[model samples]
Target: MNARLVGSGSDTVVLAHGYGTDQSVWDKILPDLARHHRVLAFDWIFSGAVKDQDMFDPVKYSSLDAFADDLIALMEEVKPGPSVYINSEGYEGGFDISEVEQLLSSIESDFHSWASSFAPLGVDPNDPPSVTKFQNCLKRMRPETALSVAKLIFLGDQRDMLDKVTVPCTFVQTTNDFVVPNSVPGFMAKKIKGKSTVEVIEADGHFPQLTAHLQLLEVLRDVPGFDL
Candidate 1:
C-alpha cells in the first residue's frame, strides 16, 4: 500500500487529480509548487490507482464517497492537514451549485456530467484532443450510464466534510466546466467556511492538469498564505 509522494518542505500542499488523468498530470506544476511547499499528488482508483481498471463497479465500493473516504484516510497518514489542497477535477461536493446538473437532468432523464468528466481523457496535453479519441470514449458510453456516474459525482453531498476540513484549499476551476463547474468551486469557497481560494483559470476541457498547466501553476505559486 505504498502511496506516491513528491516534494519536500515544511509548508505542505496536496494535489488530487481527476478520474482519467494520473498524478503525472501535475508534472508541470510540481516544480513550481515544490519550490516552496511540500507537495503530494496521487491518482484516484479509477485512473492512476495502485490498481486501475475499466468500468467502476458500484457494488464493490459504491459511490465516489468510497474514493473520497480512501483519500481522507491516505491524507491523514501522509499529511494531516495541508496548507493548500488542489482538487483538479475531483470532489464536486460542497460549495457546488452547478446549473449544468440541472440543465443536463432536464434535457435527459439520465445525466452525469461529473462522472462522464472522464471523457476529457481523450485530450492529452502532448496530443491534445483528437477527433477519433473523443468519439471513441463517448461512442461506447450510453447517455443513461454517463448520467448515472454524473449524478453520483455531482449529487455527491459532502457538505458535512467541508466543515471538518480545516485546511486552506485552492480550487482551480475551469470556465465552462460540466461536472466541477465554475459554480461548484464558487459555492465551495463560500460554504467551506474555512480558508479557501478559488482560482477560475479559463481553459478548454474539464481536466486542468492537461489543458491549463501554466495557469494552474500560477495559482499554486501565488496562493494566499502558501509561500510555495
Candidate 2:
C-alpha cells in the first residue's frame, strides 16, 4: 500500500486509477489539480509500478471489494478522512457477460492487439506510443493475473454497493468510452445513496486522463467540491 501526495492545500483530492492502468496516467491533470488542492494518487498492487508484489493477494483481490478496501485504506492513511472522491470508469456496473468473456479471452491470447483496440474515436488507431506504453506496463503481469482481474472488472457486478456509498461522487464518463458504456454513469447517478452527478465529457477513449486531459480538467473544475 504505497501512495504519493501532491500539492499543498486544505482540501485533498484522491485520484483513483482503474484496472489496466497506473497512477501515472493522471500526470496530465496533476499539475492543474495540484495548484488548487492536495492530490493523492497510488498504484494498485497489481500495477507494474508497484515494487512490492507481495502486497497483491490473488484470492483477496479476486473481487472488486478488495480494490475498494485498498482505496479506503489509502485515504484513511494519507488524509485520515473523507474528501472529494473522483473515480475513473463508472463502477455502477454494466457489461454483457458474453462480451466480457470474449474480450478477456482475446486479451489472454493477444494482449497487445487487445490493448490497441481501445484507442479513442479520433486518435490514430495505428497503435500509438501511448497504447504501446500502456500495453508494456500491462504486459508485465502474468496472463493469468491480467485475465483474473479483467474477469472481476468486466463480469463482476457492483451496483449493489451503490446504495451503500454515502460519499459525494462525480462520475466522469467519457463519450465513446469503449470499456464502460456511456449509460453506466447515468445509471449510477440515479442509484447512488448520496449526492452524485454525472459529467459526460465530449471525449472518447477509456483513458480520458491521458487522452483528454484539458477537457477532463474543465469538467472537474465544475464538479461540486472541485470548484477551485
Candidate 3:
C-alpha cells in the first residue's frame, strides 16, 4: 500500500493529476515546485501501474472519496507534516462525478432526465487532449482499464471532503479547457473548507501541463506559499 513517492520537504505539496494522465504529466512544473515545497505525485490505480485488476475492486477506489483516501494515504506516508500547498487537477474534469448516482437513481425509478443534468464540456468527447503526445498515450491505454475507470469517474459525490482538508488548496482551472469544464472547478472551490484559490488560465487544451505549462507555472508561483 506504499504508493509512489517523489520529492521531500516540510511544506509538502501533492499533485493530483486528472484523468487520462499520470504523475509524469507534472514533469514540466515539478522543478519549479520542488524549489520551495516538497512535491509528491503518483498515478491512480487505473492510470497504468496497478497489476491486480481485481485489486481495483469497484467497492474501494471506485469513487472520489476512495481516490482521495489513496491520496491522503500517500501524503501520510511521505509527509505527514502540514502542507502549505495541495495543487489538485490544477485544471478540469473527467466528467460529472455525481452522474453515477444520478444515472443509477434514474435507472431504478423510471426517470429519463438524469443524464441530461450533466453539462457537456462543449467539445468533442471522442477527441483527445489538444496535445498530440497525450493523445498518443491515451490511445495506448488498456481498453478494459479505461472502460472500468470511465464508469468509476461517473460515480459519487466527494466534493464534501474538501471541507475536511485543513491544508491550503489551490486549483488550476483552465478557462478554455473542455474535458473537465469550468463548473467542476467552481464546485470544488466552494466545497473545500480551507482557503483555496482558483486561477482561470486562457488555455485551450485539457492537459494544460503541455499546452499551458508556463501559465500554470505562473499561477502556481503566484499562489501564496507556492513561491517555488
Global lDDT scores for all candidate models: 0.59, 0.72, 0.58
Winning model by lDDT: 2
Q: Compare candidates 1 and 2 on TM-score and give the better one.
A: 2
| Tens-digit per-residue lDDT, 54-84, candidate 1 | 4445453457667768878888887635456
What tens-digit string does per-residue lDDT give for candidate 3 at 62-135?
56667768777777667547665443343234545475455445533432222222112322233344344454
Q: Which tens-of-lDDT digit does each residue in 165-185 have in candidate 2?
A: 787777877777666677887
Give the Å shift of residue 145 in candidate 2. Answer: 1.6
| Ten contiguous residues with the weakest lDDT in model 1 | 130-139
Native-vs-model 1 lDDT?
A: 0.59
Query: Each candidate: how many clashes?
Result: 5, 0, 3
**Regions more than 4 Å wrong, model 1:** 52-57, 76-83, 90-151, 159-166
Clashes of 2: 0
The C-alpha local distance difference test score for the whole of candidate 2 amounts to 0.72
Better-scoring candidate (TM-score), 2 or 3: 2
Indicate the residue-level lDDT of 172 in model 1.
72
